[model samples]
Target: MRSSVRERETVARWDVARPSWPSRTAGVSLAGFRDSSAGPVDVPLVPHPAVTLVVEFGDGLFVVGDATGRQQRGSLVAGLAPGAVRMRGENVTCVEVRLSPVVAYAVLGVCPAELDRTVVALDDLWGRDLSRIREQLADAASWEDRFALTDSLLARRRETGPLVDPEVARVWDRIVISRGRVRIEDLADEVGWSRRLLWSRFRSQIGLPPKRAATLVRFRHAAHRLAAGDNAVRVAADCGYVDQSHLHREVVAFTGMTPSTLAGDPGLAVDDIAWAEPVAHLGVMRKT
Candidate 1:
């Protein structure tokens, strides 16, 4: 009966309809993908800023490196393709979780808050069986369940506060209402703090700084558009990138491949990219 229950709890194993990994060069057995053009992942590792959740339906392992392509602590890294990041085990496994970039920053506050040189043990933050999350996430479940779990995990990290501070809350309100055209200078002025001072505090609290956060916001917005399957060049210009190369660079930073590669990856999952985005600079976004 438990076995039957488990079967119904998840989509039939064969029911997982995955995209054909467009590029054979992406490597390994590919088997899952997400439409990131929606918004930041309900999980965190934003492949395009909006693609927060990735579903994986297979196994593989990989080596991870930083923006410099060197292995280091706190550097962003991820599993290559279906099984990109390698561990000692001969076999690997997974399911999928849709997370938000904010979730990573909030949870990772216990460590150095930059993506450079960071080697994250997926089991340390979430459970070892990445697939278990999907089992618990069935249609028959309660909506509050996930949010409650998120809150509980967050409490462990001690990242809960004025999600939008009373002071910052007002500013967040202004920023959000502005519809993605906000500037760091204007926010600093509104918050009654110097741009530098505000940035310092922002980094401490948000894990990432403000300007980069703005990039995240823009990427999320643009990715949502990209999921619609528009021309890459046209989409790049509309997203405020200087050109498709700029878009390609960001895509590579988040995901280890290029935009020309298959956007619909049947094998990529959020846990795989536990820490792979390059910082713009030492204290900024990742550039590798």
Candidate 2:
């Protein structure tokens, strides 16, 4: 009976029928978006700690790197983007999965560090596996099926791929659960590792060192609050900034926009339609 109950729970957890493909799996969430615009729309992609996988089923989605000045069109893996980027495409339809850095190595077969502030074609990373998934996504009958296919593929890949160090995973989870409020020293102690060793391993596997990762996670929470119509001053105070000035600097650094401008950013506005609920479910978007 317990086994039967567990099976039922598992099915319920993987139910792809949810609004934005909230998964029962930790460290993974998926969202499907469809746009019919004839001309391209620019979306200011915010830098976050997650490694994102974008699979397009319709028109191409081009990732334009602000620094590299190169554009990658079609399915891709965006790794721990350090600064703002933009996505330009028209009549776009895609399924985007955000992977917590903790599990990205297992799913992508590459350390998040390799992708730091870079975008690579998905075919380059996953090879033929990505092409196969794209075909499956395009052929799938409905959004639910597409999500289910995506989830099953991720689950299979993660199960087969090598995992990050357990200690590193624990530290990442702690930072995320604390919404980036925890200290690196405390995390090292909790995970039974010296600070130096923890820093090295964490950066190698998770893309960013502990301190920077914490700040990125915190900033994402603050960005969401601003988008939700929270006052910039209150958001700064609530998200642990030293002052509104500090908050402004962090926001500008990550997004290249001031707090008020970020709040009004049409690009940042896509979170409402595409990822708002799944992000909250992932625990990245915290109540604080």
Candidate 3:
């Protein structure tokens, strides 16, 4: 299904499309975005707890750059917690895929560690197949067709690629279930591994150390809460921060914006419609 979204105080507009049903492959969510504004678009890219792949089509200028000024145009893959990024373009059209880091290792055919905290050209990882997929997506007749094509490609890659350790996967699930409040030591104990081993294995397979992963997950939840109009003090307390300032530091660390500014960001304003199920499950507002 598709919907139109406009920022509350700006002229920026987007036609957002969501899949009719859940992806057949677990831990995968798809959304298609087409910029409909008359002028160029620029917005902060908020960090989330998953690996992101953007497949750009149409004759538009799409660019993603980091805080360091490194930039890539067209299709790209961003690993977990890529800090302080921004997306800019004109007439942008793309299918954005969010892959749970647990499943990302297999579907991407590489360890998440390789992509940790950075964005790389999809072509750099997928090679020529990236071109073929772009062609197919651009040729697809409708949003549903594009979703099906993307899902099929991911399912095939996941079936053939190496899976992460069961213990590590379990830990990731625990982290999400607890909303990142779970302790790494407790998780290691529950999984019957030494703290050191779990730390090394999770970092290698899931992209971030256990502690860092928890922090990112926590921040993801807190960010959505902020965007939903929750009071900062309440969000900070509920999300496990020591105080509001601690939450402030994390918000600035992740997006280079203070809480109030991020809460009103246009990119996050579209998140509720674009990622409805995940956002709902995390207990954030239905509209941001």
Candidate 4:
């Protein structure tokens, strides 16, 4: 079986490259999440074109699609643990479909015993070429055929829960509007709650604070500049840092690696997608 993506609008669509990964052919599959292209999302690494995916197996694998004329060239990678926070650089376009852990939990509904096992087994299949699936969708296939298939997979996994909570939605909205550069206090105020209340919501829902989110946003900006060969000073300034050292110091605090090290460290390059979570989403350029 294959996973399908349907783009009903001209604005944003999943631009998948031709089928690869011979291992992708059958099993469970789900659609990608829908996100806005109004601004940039802070992700790790400087991915050229990527297909960002968030599945259930060991924190879903990160993907990017840099198809010509189809998407932008930049970097953004995230894990599937809680919320996947990614940053796509300017001129980098891609459709990110990262399912929340809650979504997986909802899909599973706590029935399957080998939750991770089932997800891992079907992980590759989830991303298999969905051209067939897309075609059926384009032809206005039955909702049961599409949605029901997904439901069945979750049922098999015994994962079930609410798709997401209101607090999660609230924080995500803040991330988009602020470009990942807002404060926890501000978020607290916006939601008409106290700091402790906001923190509780964050830990339980988003799993991170407003400050961490802001940090990641800044870090993403700086990483993009470095990938594009931007001067550290300029990148720092552009990303809301006091100076180049500010960028480096904060990046170290959050990522334990320097921008210079990241740029030169070819080993860090892999399947060609940002995949790890930093200490928190501190500014790549202004964490400390």
List runs of model 1 lying over 4 Å from the truth: 1-119, 122-180, 267-288
For candidate 2, which ten residues in a row score worst on lDDT? 279-288
Give per-residue lDDT, candidate 3, residue 115: 95
The Cα local distance difference test for each model comes to: 0.39, 0.76, 0.87, 0.40
| TM-score-superior candidate, 2 or 3 | 3
lDDT of 4 by residue, 1-288 (tens): 011112111123222221111111121233322222344433432221111233221112333332121222222223321121222333332222333333433432331222311122222333342333333433433333434443344454434244445665576566645655677777778778898877665545443454565565567656656754678888887777888888888766544568886554332222112222221221111111
- Model 2 compared with the native: what TM-score? 0.85
> Per-residue lDDT for 104-181 in model 3, tens only?
988898889999889999988898778888899999988888888999999998999888899999999999999999
Clashes of each: 49, 0, 0, 39
Q: What is the lDDT of residue 145 in candidate 4?
A: 42
Query: Which 10 successive residues of model 1 have the least lDDT summed?
Result: 279-288
Show pairs that collide, candidate 2: none
Number of the candidate with higher TM-score, 1 or 2:
2
Candidate 4 is scored at a TM of 0.45
Better of 2 and 4 by lDDT: 2
Query: How high a TM-score does candidate 3 get?
Result: 0.93
Q: Model 1, range 1-288, lDDT digits (tens) per residue?
A: 435323321321111222221212111122222222222221223332211222222232322343444432211223212111212211222222332333434443432244321345454444533335434433213323433333344355434422323454354445435534588898988889888887777665444566765665565455545543577898788777889899887666654556654243322222222222321211111111
TM-score of each: 0.48, 0.85, 0.93, 0.45
What's the CA error at residue 95 for candidate 1, in Å? 7.3
Q: In TM-score terms, which candidate is top?
A: 3
At residue 206, what lDDT does model 4 achieve? 43
